[model samples]
Target: MGRPAIEVQGLWTQFGNQVVHKDLTLAVQRGEILGIVGGSGSGKTTLLRELIGLQPPSRGRVCILGEDIQRLSAAEQRRLSQRWGVLFQQGALFSALSVFDNIAFPLRELRTLDEASIRDLVMLKLRMVGLRPADALKMPAELSGGMVKRVGLARALALDAELLFLDEPTSGLDPVAANAFDELIGHVRDGLGLTVVMITHDLDSLATVCDRVAVLADQRFIAVAPLAEVVQLAHPFIRDFFHGERGDRVLRAAAQPASSPGGA
Candidate 1:
């Protein structure tokens, strides 16, 4: 296994009188796809935000790529920010920008590439996400939900980040599209050697792309292990989650051996 790409120690988060996480500790290995799962309000998103420095833990340390993000100098933070990309739950594209320009936004903001190079890169990203060159001319309002997600993914990968953060990457898609999207994630993970941290309610995603699963419960993670083992955990939530009807079905499908398994 590679060195830890993300490390959190003694994490705590609170809002008003509500405590979300308490004393959570975790380490995500490099090049691994880790699924963050829990019941509706288990602090899954909170933890993601904290790890990415969007929200500060009331008490804890978050270190990414060996630098404590909270402690980094402004210049260091800027450089670190370039190392990863995030796909929000909703496709948060700028309505004013065309699809191609949205994909190019990061490159324009972060690098010195000229318009020609940027256009070439944007085209490549569009193709990488299985989007047509023609789709680039469409507005965000003109795309389907799945296309919107793909565009968001293309934009996230625009800068060639080493790490990718996805919030419910498959939510709101039909089963077939969701399945294809899962494979796409794995495709990019291997092709780009990217470490992926995804927060999802999709059990099949955990089975399909996640190398490990982290279950958040009781204000912290109950376990972080391979899906097979995580399902067998003795916690009530874990039992109810994985042994439930839908979960059991998806997990069974996931444990099946693939003849050519190449996608995420």
Candidate 2:
């Protein structure tokens, strides 16, 4: 509804002779959840790294929250980082740290908070992600797959970021857990008033959570629109991605007649 939270103009990223993205331009509006999807090796993660300032683009500008990220000084970049958070493909929690410490990591880096305040903030973050207080004492290795994801999410939200990035958030969970996680994301987004940009291959997730989807191909987004509108497109990749065999299954499921109470 407001201005763009992220703006990329003429973004070009290259790894030696392989160009991952070329002239890629897009703007992610504030308070929206946008999913980016493409075939394997379509540069989803690469694009995320570029946006987060981990991977610098060979050409073009990346602006975050109205400021040109690439032009910012070291100190300014660090300050801007506090406004956003990212959950990588596999949670990526530090194995050496307990869940509590992982959630507290970013807060500790601020070096301004006393231990008591840090504990209180960390507990709040854990609750926001649906984790229990007892979980704080467990190391990453002790958590189950779903619990690990929640802890990573807690750590990501620990800084109270308005913008969130998720890379395959539901990748390893069972269908039940995946659906629950999707609902959790929706709840958290609306509850926190956060802007989320996610890179995911889960179609059900797109149908359930994303407000819009950006389909990447030929080194650029061929379409960025609501799932309903984008799924109707005839583009080869877009059509197959949304209406192919797997997509057909999703569609078929959606078309199934709902059973009446106690009736087959």
* Cα-based TM-score, every candidate: 0.94, 0.93
Scanning candidate 1 in windows of ten residues, the lowest lDDT window is 255-264
Given candidate 2, what's the lDDT at residue 53? 89
Local accuracy of candidate 1 as per-residue lDDT tens digits, 26-48: 98887789899999889888888
What tens digits encode model 2's per-residue C-alpha lDDT throughout 1-264?
A: 556888999999888999888899899887788889999988999999989988789999999999898899989999999999999989999999999999999999999999999999999988988888999999988999899989988888988998899999999999888988988888888888888999999987887777778999888889987776777778899877788778876554434442111100
| Poorest stretch of ten by lDDT in candidate 2 | 255-264
Task: After superposing candidate 1 on the true structure, give the runs of residues whose Cα lies further than 4 Å from its correct spot.
Answer: 257-264
Q: Model 2 — TM-score against the truth?
A: 0.93
lDDT on C-alpha atoms for all candidate structures: 0.87, 0.86
Name the lDDT of candidate 1: 0.87
What clash count goes with each model? 2, 0
